[model samples]
Target: MSLTRVLWFAGVIITLAMGIRHSFGLFLEPLSAGGGRETIAFAFAILNLLWGAAQPFAGAWADRAGARRVLVAGALAYAAGLWTLAVPGMPLLGSVMIGIGLAGTTYGVVFGVVGKLAPPHRRSQAMGLTAAAGSLGQFLLLPAGQWGIDHLGASPTLLVFAALTLLIVPLAWPLRVEGIERPSQPVGDAFREAMRHPGFLLLSASYFVCGFQVSFVGVHLPAFLADRGLSSSVGALSLALIGLANIVGTWLFGHMGARHDKSRLLSGIYACRALAIVLFVLLPVTPASAIAFSAAIGFLWLGTVPLTNGIIAGIFGVHYLSMLGGLVFFAHQLGSFFGIWLGGRVYDSTGSYDPVWWASVVLGVMAALLCLPIRERPLQRAEAGA
Candidate 1:
């Protein structure tokens, strides 16, 4: 298949898969209203853990088998998870299954394939474009999810989402590669080697903050807005704007990664996130303020994905891209688990999200600091040097 076609297919898969995943947080309130916030939060927290846990295996499968198999299986799991989620009293089941589904369909698997397909010069741009599609999904689907809740309620809306995930089945076909690309080292050895590299460790550590902050907001922001006496539609619009801003942010960063030090770019993005969060919290929460905050954070949202992937590909090469990326993402999901779980726990104890917001701000600064030291070049290996 043509590279253009591959990118198109990969982009659509990301959009649909991420669209449903991003909007699932909308159901947190409706589901938890009965079970209490902790129950729902735990379920989401588990989902993040499972999503992270499953990623390395999913990526390895894609690397060893093919993207087609992993993606199709994910699409099926996604449909089942959504269907289960629609049924009342199945939050944990739905969360675990959907989290499992997302592992196969999301960044590691899709971008790994794209990394292999795109030429070296253009790979970052391809990943940026793909990440942008995921943001576009958030922008396009948040309102649709909000609309579904308004008209159909959460259960039926999830059933609608079950149908939506099925769309990924066809999209995965184009990503099927002829064979695994040759790696500089065996997959097993690469993971062991990368783990020892300071740059890789720093990259993973910073990504944890990314997962923590983004998942916290993605899952809880709607309810956060509701707590402030804003309409749910306002929350929906805010999410849409975040998604819209991500399109530009992701593309710009992708282009810049090609030309600049991606590590500095990452540091810049993280610093921007810290400043944005501080400004958001210090300022009063008005409808205008809320919308502006969404736009600001959304630009920084998911922009890290391509740059991180580009760095990994630069350091480790594409042969083991999926596996390495997934391992890095696992750290991200660990942070995600804490972020989602803590948001509710803190709220349940204090009746405020103030602490959580401040924690994220601090993490943003730490992430910025860590990102600066990442070596954005290929890993030095005796085998490759020979």
Candidate 2:
């Protein structure tokens, strides 16, 4: 098969896996009721934590072996975890298992495959397409989950989603594996070299803010709308709109990253986010306005992924792309943990999400500023030689 066909196929499988995983937010209420709010929170935290922690290993395994083995095992684990979530009173274990499964299947393995297939010039666009597929999944699935909850109920909905994950196994079969040649530098040394790079640090830190904003809003936006006396459907629609908009956003950013200074583009995206959040808070909360805000913000959502991954690939080469990208994602997930957990804690304490909203705006601005001084050109010869 052609490279485009391979990418499109891989995109479908990765998007489905991630989309179903993210749609779990729709189950928070039911899961919380079954296991208690704290338990549910812990489960999600564990999920993100394990998912992040496992990426480096998964990436390395994929680099040394091939994504096929890791991805198939990951698909089984992901399906099993979703199935577990369907069982009553199994929230904690189910969530942790789901995280482990996600670690192997999602970003690391999928991107590793892309790194292998895509040429350097087209890498950013490939990442963009892949990320857009993930957003598409979010746009499509969250509402499906809501519908299932309202009409069919959460447990059955989850089971159905589990079945959907089985699709990953067959989809992964097309991945072409070229055998690994030994790295000129030791893997540990390469990792250390990446860690010490200024661009990598900036990319990782900026991604943290992206995670913070996206996770908080993704998890709480529906509830926030409900608290304002809007219908639950409004909240779901808002999220769906965001997911839809992200498709355009990611594609645009992917194209731009290929030609422009990626770091500056990242700064601009964050700056736009800060402005959007502030305006959203200031605006009236009408349904029309809510949908408008969701669409606008969604366009900016996940746009960072392509740029961030692109920078890593550009700076470091595809040989260790998955391992380094996984580390950056680890930072993103850590921020996600804080964003989701803190949003919940603050809501419980204050009965309002105003503080969290304000915090998001502030962090967004700070993140933009952080990206301003980032040097995006390839490393100096001396640095590269290291």
Candidate 3:
């Protein structure tokens, strides 16, 4: 019942969930050694799609049945999904299972509980701290994952990660809310209301760009660096740098979200992302430059998470925060599906990632424009508790 206790457990769980997820890029080289770049990318793409598609349902169930149930189930599935990756012919199944598992274990379910635990005034900060914990995981775990692949074989490394993921099962208990927080309106009515809101639509559209840009970079950046004659360690360090910067960025943005206009903040973050990508690509490829780029992009990374969720909570109220956030995240994942799959397709055909990099810049500008118009206030119905 203590907010501290809840945030602590929730933060650890996110660290594990997101940390491992971020390291998936590290596996691409090892997996693609047999010439299946698209295959691996598609598997990851499926993971994002399934995670997005299942999130609303997962969040809804957490809203009603409690997050412990959803999180524990998700942890089991996540572990199973990882173990399944050891099977030589079942990457698709592994990806699908992991995707569904991620839906239950990560943002939607965890934020649902945290949203209820923290008071409205401190809500954005709490979410930011929790998301920062995830960035910390990325910072710590990326190198560890790369080490595992270096020492143990990739399959063995995956098995170890599977074992580690099971830790989420016990971590789920501390996150249990005291009681269900019922929505002010029926679930169907909430969905319909969200559908009619222009701001939510615009927010979701911009989030799609977030997903497209982040996913493409997360999955393909390693290969892109390799194509430029960088070592695998450079690639791993680049992702770790992103994670490291994300810790500050997520926390800073979350703290600011409490004070500023979240929509405008989001617009700036996207614009910065486009600028970072442009600089990274146009400049020469070197380890120092990659690290600088990673740090810059990373600072802007996942800053979107807390801000986006905070905006949704502001607009919809916390009672349906998880479900509404899930809906918005589904848009993000849809962008992820395209961005990642497209990166692989383009690279496979053109032998370069230049086109997708340009596409990300274009989408970033569009998202920045889109965020300018979002009305961050709650609906009248929500304010009135109708």
Candidate 4:
């Protein structure tokens, strides 16, 4: 019953954060001009960079202090960021604030709490439930964002999201698990240890492919479809299909993680992703092909999160899960930075996404090979008193 409540609250927080975040672009459009669209892009870039940059520190803080304090600050910052959307000359700054907020409110911290609270047997399931919750939010929010924007208008919608984000404050109280450090080692030392681990470095490096693949596909797929002479609706529906299918994908992989070796699973995901992308463009570009491809790709989407977080906890212990996971995620965000920018740059230069598509294939193969040799054994400190 206790775990149930904790998962429920954590789910709500993730759902709210993910759902409202997608809609931010809608409301921000009205605020652009004089390359304001580019301004928004730059702001989003800043947000992603800051979110990655801040995550490890946030994770470390959450590890040392209880999560409740960090969560409250994140909630407030999120609310304040939404409110900033209503202000003049504030969208960019709001992005910065929200970036900081996300470092606390997002997966590393929430899953760190979940990972700690879960018994060894059920840890993967807990992580799955959380990922499923966020996937559900993404599915629902796509249409909901359009409706809310049309009905509420930009300013009111921003205000509404601000109010909604505050709910995370109270919800955070139920999952305030404190950090557990090794009895003999300082928290900084745990991070230092990870910094030295080849497995940790490789794991972090592989996740960059994840961020790159997902962001590139998500951002450029619609445009790619258009270039192939497909209808815009085809592109839009394909994205929606990916979101809807992702819920099942995340849960399925999460379920699989408990019974199988997570490293092999991660490798399989990247390999399958590579195969799917190859088939997607190589096959036909019809609506049917598009939907099928989208669904296949979507099924692989976010399948990495639970398994990756589970592996990190399994290998390192959950004592510094958030901080360590945050560092890994920061690497993922940097990959995201390069993925989106490079995809656009290539398309503009070559008038084709094939080069980027081929790049995804190469990266996928690399990530697949990368995960195979990762040592999945728990860190030595895990067996000692913390």
TM-score of each: 0.97, 0.94, 0.98, 0.88
What tens-digit string does per-residue lDDT give for candidate 4 at 168-224?
A: 999898877634443355777887898999888989989999988887777667667
RMSD of candidates 1 onward, in order: 1.5, 2.2, 1.5, 3.2
lDDT of 3 by residue, 1-386 (tens): 89999999999999999999999998877877778589888998999999999999999888878899999999999999999986776888999999999999999899988888888888999999999999999999999999999999788889998999999999898777775546657888888989999999999999999999999998898889999999999999999999999999999999999999999999999999999999999999999999999999999989999899988888888887788899999999999999989988899999999999999999999999999999788777734543
Between prediction 1 and prediction 4, the one with superior lDDT is: 1
- lDDT per prediction? 0.90, 0.82, 0.91, 0.80
Summarize candidate 2's per-residue lDDT along 189-296 as a digit string, tens digits: 768988899878988898889988888888778777877888878988898888899999998999898888888899999889888888888998879888988998
Clashes of 3: 0
The residue ranges of model 4 lying beyond 4 angstroms of the native Cα positions read 22-39, 85-91, 149-159, 178-184, 223-236, 347-352, 381-386
Q: Give the number of the best model, judged by lDDT.
A: 3
Candidate 3 wrongly placed segments (more than 4 Å): 179-181, 382-386
**Which stretches in model 2 have alpha-carbon errors above 4 Å?**
34-38, 179-182, 379-386
Model 2 TM-score, 2 decimals: 0.94
Pairs of colliding residues, candidate 4: none
For model 2, the local distance difference test gives: 0.82
Lowest-scoring 10 consecutive residues by lDDT in candidate 4? 28-37
